[model samples]
Target chain A: MSPLVIAFLVLALLICGSALSMLWTKNLLHAALAMFLTMLGLAGLYVLAYADVLAVAHLLVYVGGVLILILFGIMLTNQTNQTNQTNQTDTASSKNHLMTRESSRLLPLSIGLSFFLGLFWLFTKGPWMNNLPVTGDSKLKEVGLGLLTEYAFPFELAGVFLLIALIGATFVAKNHD
Target chain B: MTDIPVLYFLWVSAFLFATGLTILLLKKNTIFVLMGIELILNAANLNLVAFSKNDPSMQGLYLSLFVLVVGVCEMAIALAIILQVYRNYRAIDVDQFKSEF
Candidate 1:
């Protein structure tokens, strides 16, 4: 086992374990923390795959942006009634107000397991281009050039789309009364 | 350094998709469902990046980049909507949105 493969295994374990913890935990705050770990591991995986630019972008977008958005969402939408009820009955756990409700677990877990197994079998059985020559180089320059030249139109479009979405989100979130 | 087989990435992504799907189904909180959606999106992005790792054209990389942008936009809009929903209903659980009909 080479160093790269070892790194991949460690990152993969980090990702999968945190993902499972996110599923297993009922506390919304715990899930958010788990998601942070998962995103970090995924960035590592992207770097391992030689998509360094994407990895950095992912780290910035997810860790810096999306996670903060999620934390805000959780804080803003907390169930005060549930917290008050728990506060009286369970003083020890009263400080933890981020608990979230979930449906019955058996069915979903079984379905997810079966779906994973099916995909596992399919990917392993399918004929794939395994011997392609590795082009292990940073793609920062080509990506920048392509974004400015060949992909200029779509890149500009994406910028406009992001602006519209942000404006619309603020508009929608504003109090209507 | 020997390149890691693309199959490994595929397997990991498949697991991620399944986990995301399960989270989507099992969780009642709207925010949790959104997190699941993000997981599924990242799973697909990983697949694209892995495929483009050996391709000189790097189309998959470009597409994944766009996917990431679109995903961020979606997340922003969805969370905004969720905030409005919580304000209107005073609850963020999916089951609480039952119609009177």
Candidate 2:
């Protein structure tokens, strides 16, 4: 087995494992941490796939941006029930404030497992172009040029959209006295 | 140099999608549901990136870039809305938002 394939397998394991951990854990903070690992592994997969630009962007956007946003969300939306329980209980159990409510595990797990199996069977059976000469070159230059040139309009639109969303978020989150 | 098979990416993405779906269904917290939605979006992005790995035009790559931006925007807006809902209702659980009617 080649080093590249080994790296891909390792990253895939990391991603799948972390995602499963996120699903299994009820603590919102733990799920956030698991999500961090999942995103990191995903960035590595993007690198392995020769999308280095996207890998870097994914790392920055997900790890640097989205994860922090999620953590803040978890912090801000602390459940009053958990806080009251912690107040009643010992100080050591205060950390359990992040525990979240979830439905019965059986049905969801069975549905997810069946869906995965169905998709796995479909992908393996479907005729996909196989053994094509894979390009190992970086896509940084092409992506930059394409973003500025052929995709220039949409690129600008995305920037404007992001600006609008940020402003709207601030507006919506403000005290509505 | 052995390239990783596209089928491998497909399988991983399928797993991710199913997990995301389950999380969405099982989690009562709005933020947890949002994370599940993020997973689903990333699963689709991975599919696009893997398919575009071979295409000279790199259309899938560009589309995935846009998807990423849109996802960030959605996350921001949804979290903001969630915050407001929590303030109004004092709870972030989906079932807690019962109307007084």
Clashes of each: 0, 0
Model 2 over residues A1-177: C-alpha lDDT tens digits? Answer: 889888889999999999999999988989999999999999998887788888998999999999999898888888758545757656567754577889988998899899999998888887777445346578899999999999999999999999999999989999999
For each candidate, what's the DockQ? 0.77, 0.76
Q: TM-scores, in order shown?
A: 0.95, 0.95
* Residue A10 alpha-carbon offset, candidate 1, angstroms: 0.5
* Model 2 residue B96 CA deviation in Å: 1.5
lDDT of 2: 0.89
lDDT values of the candidates? 0.90, 0.89
As a TM-score, model 2 comes out at: 0.95
Candidate 2 stretches with Cα past 4 Å from truth are A82-87, A130-134, B99-101
